[model samples]
Target: MNPIDPQLPPGDPLVMLGLLASAILFAVGIVGFLSRRNMITMFLCTELMFQGAGLAMISYGRQHMDLSGQVFVIFILTVAAAEAALALGLVVLLYRRKETLSAEAWKELAES
Candidate 1:
């Protein structure tokens, strides 16, 4: 009778809502990654996708009463942090040289 209890089955409305929200987040991330031409925005979109994956992993772990999903999220977070640091460094360096954050600026690096 506890609405907040996560014992709800796969058909539960709350579980369904979580899945829908995760899916929407993933879709938005993909769209943003594909449509955006800015390096920082695209990197942010990638983080959004990572967040969606982490949410789904945690939900599944909770449903199964397992801690592995939560554990995996820590790894995901670690990787995301590393990725953000490297990406931001690259963006900063590229911006300093080109004065813009556009993805097209990378082509110049490739030319040399």
Candidate 2:
């Protein structure tokens, strides 16, 4: 009993849809990264990029029936968690110093 019906051939529509979704997510992330002035929003955009990467990886893994891609996604998620922690810390520090969360406020560091 082959699970995929062995004779029907592999349907790739899911893979294509996953790729398309990943592309959309990546594009949105890029746009947000470029246009947003809030540090929290920027960090969220970065996370969106990571999520897109993870989706792409999982889709690839499913298409190939391999575990390595999923393992890579796990590693990416771990790194993303660490990045979020660091980014939140920076946000708190910046807010304390500037009393604002706008990206423009970061220029204060440059002048000093």
Can you write out model 2's per-residue Cα lDDT over 6-76, one digit (the tens) per residue? 78966889988998888889889999999999999999999999988988998898899999989999999
Per-model TM-score, in order, reads 0.81, 0.85
Cα displacement (angstroms), candidate 1, residue 75, comes to 0.9
RMSD of each: 6.1, 6.4
lDDT of 2: 0.90
Where model 2 places Cα greater than 4 Å from the true spot, the runs are 1-11, 108-112
Clashing pairs in 1: none
Backbone-clash count (model 1): 0
Q: Which residue pairs collide, candidate 2?
A: none
Model 1 lDDT tens row, 37-94:
9999999999999988888777777667799989999999999999999999989998
Local lDDT at 71 for model 2: 100
Q: Which ten residues in a row have the lowest lDDT in candidate 2?
A: 1-10
